[model samples]
Target: MVKPANKPQRLSLSSLKADFSSAVSRRRLVYLLCTFFVIYALCYQWQFLVSLGLGPDNIHHMTVGLIPAVGAVVLSLALYWRHLCIASVVPTALIAVSWIVTGPYLSYITLIQQNTVYLNNMYDIYVGLYLFAILFCLNMAARQFLNRKISAAIMTAVQFAAFFIIALQWVYFALYHSCITTSGALLIFQTGPAETLEYFHSLGVGRIVFIALFVALLIGGLLFANYTQKTLPRTPVYRKILPLLSLLIIFPSVGALGEEIFPQAFPIRTFIDTHDYMERSALYAENHDGKFAALQAVQLNPSESPNTVVVVIGESETRTLMHAFNPNHVENTPWLTSMKEDSDFTLFSNAYSCVWYTVPVLERALTEANFYNNKEFNSSISILDMAKKAGYKTYWFSNQGSIGVADTPITLVAKTADVSEWVDQELKQSTMDGALLQFLQRVDPNEKNFVVLHLMGSHIEYRNRYPKEFQVFNDGTVNQQADFDNTVLYTDWVLSQIFEYAKENLNLDAMIYFSDHGSDPDKGRQPDDISFKVLRIPMFCYLSEGYQARNPEVVEAVKQNKDKFFTNDLAYEFVCGILNMQSPNYDPTYSIASLQWKMERKDLVTRFGKVSLLEDTEF
Candidate 1:
């Protein structure tokens, strides 16, 4: 038999109040707390820049930056007024997109303000814009799909979750981006509103601030829940102001479409446009299909075939800090100094990076004259392609990320090479010399090979970028001198090691090395920091003793033309002097190693759409 069950009495108001007071809903408090905190922090920090008065140049960015905060506040208020507790996905999606699209330009503020800022070349600007837009779209989609919450508990949990993830990201960026204030500011700004909380963390005050904000949000959330229970109508004040909010959003959209969207989406034919060149020129170059009326290359045939010629394309390696290139710097390059003493090596003292950035110069330098056209050539004709056509084994080894997983120029360059190797994925980490070892092991001593090594060289995140074990300077933090010399020394050591391995294992003939472009380490100057150290890089053609002994004329020619050769002239002179091919446009005056040649044309655009031959004397 079953016993009859007795029902318990309903709880009293007193008991309910006691329970609520003892255990406040931690989750509900977090969202309301964080929401106001972010709003207050952004306005407070950016007040100085706001006071200076933003202008036409940055009006678009300022608009982009301001809208998200305004939207968030409006949406939150609307939900509260409607007696609603949860936010819909649509408003969240709008917030995410607005936040991300504005991401690329976040750094523009600091870039304009920084004294040491280097203006991105015209080509770099276009590339960066395209890249940033695509990345923003992808990130927005991911965030939209990933963050879903229909409950107050879940939304509060999201606040805490987002805070920690963003904090971790900022910490890594700060450490890597140490001392480079402009770069650091840009990085933090892109990471979004939450990073201000983390910036306070870096200052050791984040915990107290976060906790105080957390408590405030709890009180706000409780008040919101209580108000929603009453089913209160939205105040008339909001209804009257709705027209203003609508206008604010619609006006910006219309203006953006007119100013930026239309021209970028549909450009008319122009004789010279950098964006057009980036989009279509690669195709024209590959097929030799463009009106390339401006340039040509002459080929050089070797008297005796050599086993291998290796070219190292170093990144951000500048002469300003290199002792071998500038006497004022301390002796930081013992290996390079010794290499310079060797009779077979020809060093050019006056070499400069034609462009301030990497990819444009990389495309221009390696692609010969064809790189400067406006056709849609997704595939490129690099030196590796030419070498492969000439029946030599061509290889490309790089430490740079494959800008895209598929259909990117870097990948195309790799595929065109007979053998291509890219070491880093997600561009996690790399060094110049480490990327080179990929090729050294595979090359056969008996085969004729042409290998190009693209190094990370002295790229930013200057301190952790190089291995700590390899660090020679004890300044405890990174400076231009220590960071650069450490990187240079590491690169020098790697080159020396590679050279030794080649000497022992292969019948190597020559090695040519140069940087894609140099760096302006002085933090507050423009790109043309006239100090020779910034523009200068070491360019050397080192011939093996056996090769020099076997082919003295080639060695003598290099010595004679060392001073006159520009990187632009290298492809034409090299192809004519070593490969022995002839094109109708080939002219030795411009193609040869001697600095005596002049670029005959002046008005034609370079592949990057910059006016080439601005002055004949520039070469």
Candidate 2:
């Protein structure tokens, strides 16, 4: 025994090599590399992921990133590593492509705008992993019925289709500086062939060439992968059934959670929403006559004197940033600031929008429907309807889109006017709000008129909302707040132009201006992350000498209520009071121009009546 122990076996070079090789085989090494690449590529847009608390500052990044990676690695280790590795490529590539296309905008939203709502959720990464698993299952399922050639072709087609959607989103963002939304998708149906061609032409040759090259590269890569990759052996029956079950049941169940958890599916979700919106619009249009028939019975007692009333709707103009509203801010609204001293002007200090978004806010503001009234929006009579019934020549001049697919809910109200005009007929052009002046000039203001001018004021992509001449806040550099300030300045100039024109050219009796909604450019206007700045809109009324003389009590009432809490949903009633058009539906309690008008800070609710402004401490 002693003699045997003297020759104790040592680890030889061959045995050591075998042990090391067992620990990390070539396949396992490749798998590890693939997993690393995916995690790295996904997190390359650091601001997006980091905002979700999945960065170096925390351990969330490691936990979240490793879960999906470990899951994929384990599946590969248990099954065919080659098949799993190949399947992972498609989703990884798609993620990379999506990041490349949307990275700048995501960065802008998170870093520049300080809005983390766009891509800051950890659910985004989960969505990507779910998509990866789906692609893997699809690959496995395709192998069961189709030959290698057919399966490869199908997979490549799927890849191409997903890539096409990404390309379309890129094109949309390039044109609008925003992603394709449900409203935006509906806008495509509203576009004619000429407008579509014009849009593409506007993209110019450089962008067109770049898009073509991108498509070519994508096709070439997919083709190379299809031709060069070897087919895996047929799996057992249970494996085939498992993939089918995952594809048909598990993947769809996860996808059904909707866009909040899976924003990567926005394209498909947008299309579905657009379809539903179109259907609703069509139904509303078909029932338009019946919906308004009740308005015919409601008589409007008009004033004896001929008058002109102007309603100017501003977009995303937050009083928190306007000098006229916030004295501590920059003097961006010089005209409004100057108007503050005018006896004719009455600036409302505590005005809030009914909702934080344009469409919903405008829907309530333009119609008799309101949060407290519990009136159905579709059945509610619009200001245009009231004006028309009162024998006033109503006109709607908007710089925004008119019709999309069918008449949008807003467009339905606009169409009720005797004359409706839009600056951008195609809905793709980024014309200045000043373009609306031409339409104003065409109006015969000598007649008793009810005019509504919809300005594209202070919307997103604030830089595009104004010309270079209005870029007074910036010094040839990118500054989101500066750009927004410039928009505010341009909007002030626009308001002055409109007021001067109406005063000089038209028999302007009374003018009212209020924004459909406000915005928190730093935090975004999403309902989930709303702030008081996103609801605190600027509102004011201008009375002509003629109007003040005829309606002295109304003017006094408006001036007295300037500091009272007001919501734009009561705009319909207020406009009626200004017009001196009395009707059974008119409620003096809600009209800011009436002495009976009353609202308390605690009673005010915004964000479509979900959040109380008084409780929103963020103000």
Give RMSD to native, each candidate: 17.5, 7.7
Highest-scoring model, TM-score = 2
lDDT of each: 0.49, 0.69
Find the number of clashing residue pairs for candidate 2.
0
Per-residue C-alpha lDDT of model 1 across residues 174-257, encoded as one tens digit per residue? 445322232233344356668766766676567566656765775455334322332223445333354344444445444543
TM-score of 2: 0.71
**Candidate 1, overall lDDT?**
0.49
TM-score of 1: 0.56
> Model 2 clash pairs?
none
TM-score of each candidate structure, all chains considered together = 0.56, 0.71
Q: Which candidate gets the maximum lDDT versus the true structure?
A: 2
Off by over 4 Å in 2: 1-133, 144-229, 233-270, 296-307, 401-407, 421-431, 461-464, 474-481, 598-619
